[model samples]
Target: MVERATSLACDPSASETGRLLTQAFQTIRDDLEVRQAFPEAALAEIEQAVADPELPERDETDVEFVTIDPPGSMDLDQAMHISRDGAGFRVRYAIADVPAFLHEGGALDAETRLRGQTIYCPDTRVPLHPPALSEEAASLLPDAVRPAYVWDIRLTADGERETAELYRAMVRSRRRYTYTEAQELIDGGDAEEALLLLKEVGELRIAREIDRGGASLPMPEQEVGVGTEEDGCDYTLSLRPLLPAEDWNAQISLLTGMVAARIMLDGGVGILRTMPEPTEGAVARFRREVEALGAQWPEGMPYGEFLRTLDRTDTRHLAIVNAATFLFRGAGYTAFDGELPPEDEQVQSAIAAPYAHVTAPLRRLVDRFGLAVCEALSAGREVPDWARAALPDLPDVMEETGRRAKAVDRACVTAVEAAVLRDRVGEDFEAVVVDGVDGDRVQVQLMDPPVSDVATGSARLGSAITVRVERADILAGEVDLRIVGRDEQ
Candidate 1:
């Protein structure tokens, strides 16, 4: 974990940051043995695939699907378009079909299995597949004919999915749009006709999902800015907003996931992604805590439903929602060979029953496996032996990979935030109490600047207070604050 810092010199060229990032990559390389046998062969095969010019082509200029991604992301996976269909919605999700080019037991597939997913550091990226495949031949680039797995989904007026069909086809992305640009089109009073139609569909989908039991949280995120020095990376804490289009796009994925789950469940011989209902004990404890804080929890409601209500009634319940996420237990890959795992007792009891991962095949190997299963089942063929064998170990592998990705992401963000705040040591700021402790340390939230920190006893969760930044270390990634006084209101 990195600590917050108070002050640091800035480097315009990001040279210093690049070096540190290189070291981080080196550490990952050694840890995963990425430089040795795994990635080398994979890279060669990928380069060959990219250079090959003989491939099928399809006309995609009419649909005009555009990509939404982070700036400078070349390994684009998804492009989408939404249209209205008689008071309903039509969503076309086109994903880069990497599997189409990479052989089943080829170098790229083997390497991807080992790496699990792409790793993003402050200054560099460790892609799961080699760049030639992930970024060039397989990437859904604009104006270039490429292979794709298209999910054409239709939804009812109320957002219930009516039908979905998947097919391997050719696509040409019309444009590459960033989240910022898509958001502007959504927020600006005048949006393109197609974008406006997309917004309407997206809003309907989000509204319907929220009405069901989906949980939405506004978690703060940090972005990295490259600079000139050896360790010169400017870390900025930036809030990534969930635009209507984003939500709408997500709904398409979610709908597909649910459909896949249902398909596997019906077949009774495939892995599914499952999340269990919240435990009675955990819910009870949370209820007591909320009531203790003079908050209300409607009785006999499911946890997801309860969370939606809390979102409306208590603003501070956001943290509680985060905490409750842990109680829901981890969802994982579960394989079945005609015999279902016991309904009452399973190995990973935390997850809801019958789990599968069918989204983001480009980003997750497990999803690729799941997609293969769906394809086989859809074709009425026997389940592939290799996929079934891999299923048993996928839960642990995915879990470990997910944990590592989260840790690295958090470390990078904390390092950047520390760098950003290091210069403000000793400056007084108004903060809200996010977590209150009595003996030695308490946590406070700076409302205007919107940062959270641990301070002395004068601050408690939900209490407003004043605090002064005492210390920040960019190298150590540490941020420390001292209690100035409690806010009088």
Candidate 2:
């Protein structure tokens, strides 16, 4: 997952720091050649198709689905409703039907193919489809009846998959909720039946993930914006600790994706998201780092379980989690036809499962194809000719777009970090030596402002130290800091 940054709803642009942040984003976009406007033909196609979408004959609108997303999310992708099913649970997940508007195979299709997926920065989003479709027409907005691929998954009370199926249907989301709101409702124990069931099933799925040896980096996302007196500053960069609801919502998506992978693999044709397990060398190195931070990785404990024990709030634990990123390397798409990829070749190492990206079609190009393949297979029909033919090229397209998206996200993070620290240059602060990326340079996580940047000189990885910021340049998205002293306590 991208290290996502949130944009708080404050007028950061009203301050000088905000101006620099804006300029930095614009420069990054310019250098990277991020597209802002849709091609004329794509826009024209959108105009022609927006009002009239091809809805599937099967109407599942009776199910009350609700969307859980980050605040300010417009290109909503997935909606879910969970309920009791005798001794099991029934999960109805609706993914926005992007293909419902695209059989013309026209300029809009070409445009979405070129873009690949939505690229999100703190300031703006470069959507896969135009706003007319992604944020509207095709989006599963509340009260708007829209076409969708609904995954009907039945899970035993223990959260084991009992049965799963996918089909196209019309769906309507009853309401939209930000993760925080959902958490509040769930915590108060006064939510609707679906949400209450969501909590139960979500916890069950989480335990399943832990038991299956899957790990997730539970690092808090950093958000920067104009700060109020309530925040005790004029501008602030702070961590937004994820809500329990967010993890629960994600479990539903993962459940659907894994089930979709099963469907496609059973049919012997589809794309699978694949990654290799961490190397012995990587594990050894991580173990060493963990010991250096005064943490214990018990003998024979799965690395995932070990990771789940680390608290993200502790300075040493934060560094430990940051170092865990190395374990998630080399993830990519695996498209297949006529036969399945080798067993080892199909599993996503981090997820520890054979997974496919079948959710979030509005944001991702590949999911549209994956969903088409899975939906066809689950419906006992031939995979669409167009989907089968495009399997070979999907990997490369996704790889290229993935690289671009990462570069942009990293650039935006850097600029924001620089902006946050520009006024504090020359100040000393407590930090943890997270890791060394290059010769004589280590990455440090600051305590006061919650910023992570490269600093000169070497130190034991995960060791506490004091660092002096020598310079910060928003335009360059760079910060110069030096290790002045090591923390003894």
Candidate 3:
């Protein structure tokens, strides 16, 4: 239930809590053996590759393209140019051409395969590619012409996708607007045609997503902060509300991925990002939990639509979002060479469509190969033998890397959670038991501070109660609480 955003701030020198968190994060990295730096061979290869990249013959730099991303992000992966195309729209989406710079099976390729994707930890970020490439050279930085996998998609007046094609090209981004900046422009009516069309197309795609039974988790993001006061240090986890521009931008990526999957399937080879639907039992449990959280789950409402109703600003609703993570189970990569996956297994149930990871090649290894495969297929050329051969092993590589990343995330968040609550040892909090009520231990969520953890006490699940904090260990990332009494009022 952890959603890590770009850190709001960090000050290890100012406070003990900050120092403890830094030490804990480093310990996890050391314990897990996560690569802190690229190997010399990989770095050397990246340097040589940057010096002489194989740029595309096609030039799309004349079309003014802009990127919308998180503030301070440098490893930009995508750029877009939207324009009117006869009663509908023309969307030109450009993805970073990692394949242009990377040699198959080289040292850099080996390094990125192991890292899998960039891990965004609070203390530090573990990048998939070296900063020289991911941040400076190969990144889709504004005003810098670079090779990219460009998707030219045509949409109907109803905002439905009509036709899509991909090709390699030399492109340049004119400006980079953060999500907030993009949203401000749209709201203030000062945005260009591309930015305005984004919102229009995004809402239509979202509607289509719901109509198609797509369920996406709107994970609440939190920013960790450490501040120095006159008396002591204060540590807090604050919710960072997501802007509408983020969702609009994501729709563009999703649209391209769906189109890429179609191409891969049509071409008779490639991999897919896949997931299975939640079981009936899981849905039932979620319904009961939603009711327990003081919300109504109207009968027959799809969980995805119900999720869209959640208010991210409300702490109670945020807990509902946290609890909904259970439905995001069984997500993984499925690779195929000749025969397509059985009709039933082909769909990514979460998106209610056939989807491929064709975006974000800068940060994800699979996307690099995916883009290469799609580009070759779109060009009516033979699929690269290296990419075809590597399909079988991709699923396993991604799973291993994803598992390790999740473990690191849980540890870091647990330590931060404990550290935040350590100061109030004897305080009583109004809490609701969310799980484990039948046993000696139960998981409780505080109403005020929005912390949830296992407490050694007996209570009915979902019942409001008063709890006293007994112990919290920052280094161990552990907390102890005992329920004193039930809250009747």
Candidate 4:
């Protein structure tokens, strides 16, 4: 059973937690210069386009495509259909056809490049495109015949790709499912034939991923939500488990990205999401830390395979995942034309393959350009002049927007963590010391509320202990604690 704190008051007449969290995040939004609305000219352009749509001439509405996303998400980007092809599988992944509506050098086009990608705050989103197009017209909503960039991928039964092609077409999604819903259907063996194929192909793809030295650390996620207390509304913090279907669904996107990268490389002109291989020094440091924590790492085992063997829910294992973030640095976009980027600049170490961002055109600026390039190449047509010109400038713009988006996410989480623990300043809570042991403080995860904060404590890495909340400043999103005693496992 998941650990729980029985003493937390569930009823709130004032809703103190919720109110504080909202106010704190709102402060973050204002401080960050997050664009709240599009300019009038941009809005007018989007409105006019929505009123009279220009859909792709080719139709693919006959295929029974279905979309899987978070519950209540309207900004749907990708829809999929999978089927058995004799001894292999044929997958059709439909991406939002944003370029169809985006005119080169138009108001919407310039504005999207400036924004780069969607910035998601818990309460509101700074959208890349106006919602009229991104969430309504361009989104892959059910029953809607939407324009899409469809990737036709043929794969062997063992998840090896044989061929991939891209084209513009109109498609209609038949059903929409949330992650939880899809997982339930798969677990109960009540999923449709297409979804069953998704599981089959997904697992095979994962096995292939492992074989190629790819590593994915499935850590539990910490989320903040609004809940009611006797005082009124409060911030509800929870640690959510990663579901299997979610991973299966993600494999499809990764496959699409890898395929997109290959297409761009073959064409010798495109942008890629690249990361360098981790250095020996970083690996050596991690090995020492894991050994000190009593985690086993057999000699000759790749780090990725070793990580797959751990239970993600264990305290030490979770800490190891957090520490592994050290090796996942220096990710960036590399745009090239004609001559290919060097081999070191073309790899994404995590996937053990070349990769590009081409799946979510509705949310990301780069995907729109990537899709246009792939579409032109697949049709034996020259790449558009506008797209070619923008390739060199895309990397800097994407990097700026990425930093803003990440800042918002981190600030919101920290704010909520502060608000949730504000009233428990004197209380002692169970925690695991994640790191900072050689310094003046340690990073700890509280058991009940699943909050992570820094505490002044003398503790070994991965060891559990009791901590007393010393202070909490909700507005600043700061929480201070002190270690009390070592937890005997």
Candidate 5:
């Protein structure tokens, strides 16, 4: 670690900060050997696959389905429509039919398996499949009439599952609504029937989730991006607001995933995305932390329900959210051939259900295999040989890519933090102690710059404190802070 600033002048401007962060990002890319280009043979195969005819004997194209995603996303994996069916609701979710274009052991398949999933960086995206297919041909783009594996999921008025079925079909998206646009439409009362049903169903499903004791850390996401002003380029770090429509949209995916898990389990073979329930000790520790923060965790209230009461912008709540990370440990994929994994290992504790990742095949490699397995079982057919053979190996590949992706994300955030605070050494900033309450060093989140990094100190969990920057190492992506005093909350 570079202890003192020697290479750059004092009080580095935003341009200098941006340059340093960019350099650090590039170094991480090189160290990870992140693949950016597809092989010529893979590209050739993708071109041919893209030009191939769409699936025949398919229906559901006139269902007026629509897609909701982040702005500028091209690899649209899902499009959906919701409607009231008598006393129940019908959700038609169409996921991109990745296996339709993927041949077993082919070049495209080989490339996707190697990538495992889309590895996103601040500056670039390493997609699992070539853009020709993931973004254009096989993507669930609006009015494109793409082939898909459609889920007809029926739920009662209380959001209890009635029946779920999956079938191959061709579908057309009526429009692509970004999260903001969709939320605005819903809020303005101009939302169509489907959007209205989404809200109703989403709330109902959330109630069901709470009943199941599912816990989710709904922390607001912090993002760093490059911006240019008249003076020079600057790095802007901001938290993206979580919208209601985003949550509603995600519920639809979860519904589909849970349905897939049930089918696979019944059929006696499939891959499941699993997480062990948080242990009693971990939950108790979190409860103690919450109590120390002067927050109430109602007796007998589920942990997940209590977390939902937190406001992300509040420092104390932020600390609680940070502490909640312990409960989310041990997430992994389980591929079973003849028997389900142990019951304790089958449920994703967060969702409080057996769940599979069958929704986002375009960006994730495991989803392809899971989708294949679910489709076969849904059709009362045997799981394909290739799919079954790849099941046991998918967990390791997914874990590797998952860790790599997490490292890249963390590195980018750390780089931006170091850059933003590079010239602020010895300056006091308000922060909340999120971790290391009893340890020698604590982790803190700066209130002004909105950065989370390590600080050396002993502080109460969730207590607001003041810290002085000790060092900011841009190359190493570190911002070391020294606790100076407690900021009265």
Candidate 6:
């Protein structure tokens, strides 16, 4: 009878806990204003274009691009295929061509600008572009000939870039593969010819980048899942490693972003994403923490250089390295009107150079704006007045939108975690200390069914301990855990 009651407390439906979760989600959805009012004439034009039997002509014969994304994802934006060219590799990146369908100064454009970017909440999403366009017409789906802005990158065997070219084109994707499927193929040596070549090129590029002081942090991420008959909604914190192919693909985007930044810098009148390097005081504090945790980072080197070294070490110090990375300043958009940013703020360590995000136009508004600027500059014409006017406000808008998106995402994850743990009030679990903020509540990571929570602890950050789940409120989106024991010194 006790076991039955415990099980009922965490039921997917009918349980008080589940009902509270559902209600919380409903409240969030209601506040998002899902129904956006778009101009009718613009909608009619877009529908008419998609409905036409004959679309624009495209050549998709030389390259067979394929998309890799999460399962059940509808708004695919990128496709890639790689091949060997002499002693180097040719990487073809095809991004969805959203601008082709958009009429300048149209209703859809206004609506997208208002929304800024996609906001993903627990139960709903405030998409930047309407689903009819973003998910269906503009998505680069398998067997679909879609318009795209393609970048062709050529790299030597040692992963040094030899040449690059950018142009607009149409492409047909040969297949759609998930991350897991692609990983299996690459690991088992059974990947398709194109995918195999891509993986090899990616490996070389990653090695070279790391050698050139590029830092990659390996941090554990939390993923939420809707449970089945046995369990209610659960939160699983897992280690998601970057696959070779994924890194290879990311390099293409990063390369383009750097190129975009260079172009803007040379042109002397454009918007840029800039981030200042970490301060010496901040680096010293982080070093103290590292030493306290009995970790070794190279002495007498720049912070960025030290970070690169830490990232290449064993898994035990992974979280510490991540915490160190947090000390760096955030990246933001800045307008350069024939003058450079303040000398101290001109460099961005994230991209290894100042950059503007010109990829992922289907999902991001900034990328679309940047693409428009690139097009105008390439044509030897001045940027549109509206786009140029947007330069001043783009920074604040991007920052505000980014903050809101992060809040919504975190709130949803927290609500789900609370729902999952509501029934196990007194269960003990093993956890690692993630942070020791506020002195009273230290954040810890739990194992069995992974989750992160604040607990009372004597040890500081990076300490491992056992904790008991004390209380949880699904609607409030909170979980209370208490430290029961610590690892012996």
lDDT of 6 by residue, 1-489 (tens): 000012223444455665776687655545544334456876776686566523335566457898887665677888888888899888788887777777657777767666677766444455677777788898899988888877677888787778765566778888999877887898899989877876777677666666655555444446654444554443323444445556666776776776667666766667777776666687788888888777777776545455545543244564476567666568787876667777556556654566678878877878776766765665467876767766777787788777666666666667777776887889988877766767677877676566766787556677778898898888777888899988845
lDDT at residue 176 of model 5 (Cα atoms): 94
Q: Candidate 2, which segments miss by more than 4 Å at Cα? A: 1-10, 225-235
Among all candidates shown, the one with the greatest TM-score: 2
Q: Write the number of the candidate with greater TM-score, choosing between 2 and 4.
A: 2
Residue lDDT tens for model 3, 364-387:
889988988998998899998899
**lDDT agreement with native, every candidate:** 0.63, 0.85, 0.83, 0.85, 0.84, 0.69
Q: What TM-score number comes out for model 4?
A: 0.95
Which of the two candidates, 2 or 5, achieves a greater TM-score against the reference? 2
Task: Kindly report which residue stretches of model 5 are placed more than 4 angstroms away from their true locations once superposed.
Answer: 1-14, 53-56, 228-231
Residue-level lDDT of model 5, residues 293-390, one tens digit each, is 88989999999999888875565678888889989999999989897788988899999999999999999999888888888888888888999999
Cα-lDDT of candidate 5: 0.84
Residue-level lDDT of model 2, residues 1-489, one tens digit each, is: 222334455556666777777788888988988877899999888887777777799999999999998777788899999999999999999999988887636898887788888887766778899898999999999999999999999999899999998999999999998888888999999789898888899899989998999987787777654466454323456776677788888899999989988888899999999989999999998888788777889999988888878776665677788888999889999999987899999999878899999898899999999999998998899988989988999999999988888898888888877877888888998898888889888999887788888989888787889999899999899989999998645
After TM-score superposition, the amount by which residue 454's alpha carbon in candidate 1 deviates from its true location, in angstroms, is: 4.3
What does the lDDT come to for candidate 6?
0.69
TM-score of each: 0.81, 0.95, 0.92, 0.95, 0.94, 0.87
TM-score-sorted candidate list, best first:
2, 4, 5, 3, 6, 1
Instruction: Report model 6's TM-score to 2 decimal places.
Output: 0.87
Q: Clashing residue pairs in candidate 6, if any? A: none
Cα-based RMSD of the predictions, in order?
Answer: 5.1, 2.2, 2.6, 3.7, 4.6, 5.1
Q: Give, for candidate 5, the lowest lDDT window spanning 10 residues.
A: 1-10
> Looking at model 3, which ten-residue stretch has the lowest summed lDDT?
1-10
